[model samples]
Target: MLHMTCKGKIHRARVTEANLDYVGSISIDEQLMEAASIRPFEMVQINGLRSAQTWQTYTIPAPYGSGEICVNGPPAHLFRVGDLVIILSVGFFTESDLERFQHRTVLVDEQNHLVDVKTYTRQSAHHIRGGEGK
Candidate 1:
């Protein structure tokens, strides 16, 4: 059996732009993508902190170190610049894979700058604690 598990997360990333004209998808900083091990076109779940809205979208890499987090297409209307959002990507894993599975969480500052990158194994999920962003 395969279980869906979180592969990576970008926590507390602020929206830098919202482009209603674009086709669709979220643009993330290349650095952030690398830190979280998120690949371009990978499906992600975005949760808005203030609005409490959740949506699914794919990721596109912005310039390296650009600190960009843009919402595009119709979803752009649901977000705004400066909104704090959590982006998560998930993948399917078999029982054996879960034994060694580790997920990456990339924490960011208010300005969407990388603060830290944390790795969590299934065993550590309940024990680890941090700021609200995580």
Candidate 2:
């Protein structure tokens, strides 16, 4: 049983069966609709994953086929294609609480997957030790 608190109420959810091959989700209450801003039994895609904080993304069925939407409260900077991001909770945010990212870029593909643009580099200890010895 997973509980998602949103709109000052608690929502109960169930994940009956889940494996690397497939995932199943069900909700017995109406909170799922309010939380995700989508109707019941709708085909939604995971737009982005939430970190250990408040952030999530989901692509809903819009008149234009599909539209990816982002909901952020806490900030995290890691994403890739075909990753299943869980939606922890949802809330309303004021305009002042929103701000742009400093050094990151995110783009969504036609398939509603989020693509992160950043380079990651790893330096060995030998490289740092050589500079320190000099």
Candidate 3:
């Protein structure tokens, strides 16, 4: 059997724009996406911390170092510029994979630039390795 598990997260990312004109999906800075191991066009769940709103959309890469986190289409109304959000991506894993799996967590500054990156495993839930510059 396969289980759906969080593989990566971009925590406390600030929305830089809300483009209602765009078709759909959230656009993240390519640097931020890479830090979280999020792939282009990968489905991601976004949670707005200020409004408690949730949106599921695919990711699109923004210009590198642009600090962009744009919410597109209908969800644009739900996440306005400057709103803090958490972006999550999940992966399918076998039961055995859980034992060796590591999920990545990326922390960003107000500008949406990655400030920290950590890799954590079930064996070391409290302590994570790897930091800034990841």
Candidate 4:
């Protein structure tokens, strides 16, 4: 998992789901897309592609139930419906939610694109609270 140091107090957060995002108007690899069509977990990556960016979707491995973030890869069925993730917001709570989110997960039937983030939640907090930046 990619690690970023933040200034705010660090609390043990659990991972819920990993969502994939691509740059520009590019779409997931045709083969990977087909795989996801059958099995969401069956995905592949085409590095150096014109219409894609590196992303990794991460999820808690259980036990503590930590947060999950999807980065540097494609979307897959490894995730289920109704999962939680982290939303790194600007302030404690504001109108601009940005890309940072908590308790967000991919929808069951909406994994075709795998980048739709509208289905995510702010963990158990209902909304994103501000944490001091590092």
Candidate 5:
């Protein structure tokens, strides 16, 4: 059996633009995508920190080092420039894969520059559960 699991995440990324005139999808810096192993056009889940809104969208590659994080199409109305958001992508994994699976979580500065990249593995999962007193 395959389980859907988080593949990568971009945390606290600032929105650089919101284009109501554009079609759809979130445009992210290609460098950031590469660092997180996120593919272009991959489905993503976005959580707006300030607006408290959560939505699903796909990703598009912007220029490397562009620091772009834009909300396009109708969803543009749901976000504002400078809004901090969390972007995530998920994929299916088998039981064996889960044992060694690693997910990347990227932290970015206000300008959307990469600050840190954290890898979560099965060991990290244990630590998380332990922290929760589970």
Candidate 6:
């Protein structure tokens, strides 16, 4: 059987832009995307901590080290600049795959710069070495 599980998360990233005129999708810094194991055009679910809003969207890579987190299209009206939000990507995993599955966590500072990275299992968590746009 396959179980839906979280694959990666970018925690507490401060929103830096909102372009309501754009088509759709969230623009994330390349560095942040890599750290969180999120691929370009991958679907992600975002929770706006301040507005208590949840929305689904795909990702677009911004310039590396740009500290960019832009909400485009309709979501722009819900999640605005300076709002802290959580971005998550999920996948379906088999029971065996869950044994060694480690969810990638990318923690960013207020400016959206990478602060640390972690890997977590159902059992425990470990801090991995951090690099790129730190």
Give candidates' CA RMSD values in order.
1.4, 18.3, 3.3, 15.5, 3.2, 4.3
Separately for all candidates shown, the number of backbone clashes (residues 3 or more apart, or on different chains) is 0, 0, 0, 38, 0, 0
Residue 85 of candidate 6: its Cα lDDT? 95
Clashing pairs in 2: none
Top candidate, metric TM-score: 1
Alpha carbon lDDT of each predicted model: 0.91, 0.28, 0.91, 0.27, 0.87, 0.91
What digit string (tens of lDDT, one per residue) describes model 6 on residues 5-57?
98999989999999999999999999999999899999999998899999999
Per-prediction TM-score = 0.94, 0.22, 0.91, 0.17, 0.92, 0.91
Q: Per-residue lDDT of 1-134 in model 3, one digit per residue for the tens?
A: 99999999998899999999999999999999999889999999999999999999999999998999999999998998999899999999999999999998898887988788888888877555344223
Compare candidates 2 and 6 on lDDT and give the better one: 6
- Give the per-residue Cα lDDT of candidate 4 at 88: 24
Report residue 24 deviation for candidate 5 (angstroms): 0.6
Look at candidate 3 and give me any clashing residue pairs. Answer: none
The count of backbone overlaps in candidate 4 is 38
Off by over 4 Å in 5: 128-134
lDDT, residue 99, candidate 3: 93
Residue 60 in candidate 5, Cα distance off native in Å: 0.7
Error at 66, model 1, angstroms: 0.5
- Candidate 1 per-residue lDDT, tens place, 1-134, comes to 99999889998889999999999999999999999989999999999988999999999999998899999998888999999898998999999999999999898888788999989899988856754354
How much is 55 displaced in model 6, in angstroms? 0.4
Model 3 ranges off by over 4 Å:
126-134
The residue pairs found clashing in candidate 6 are: none
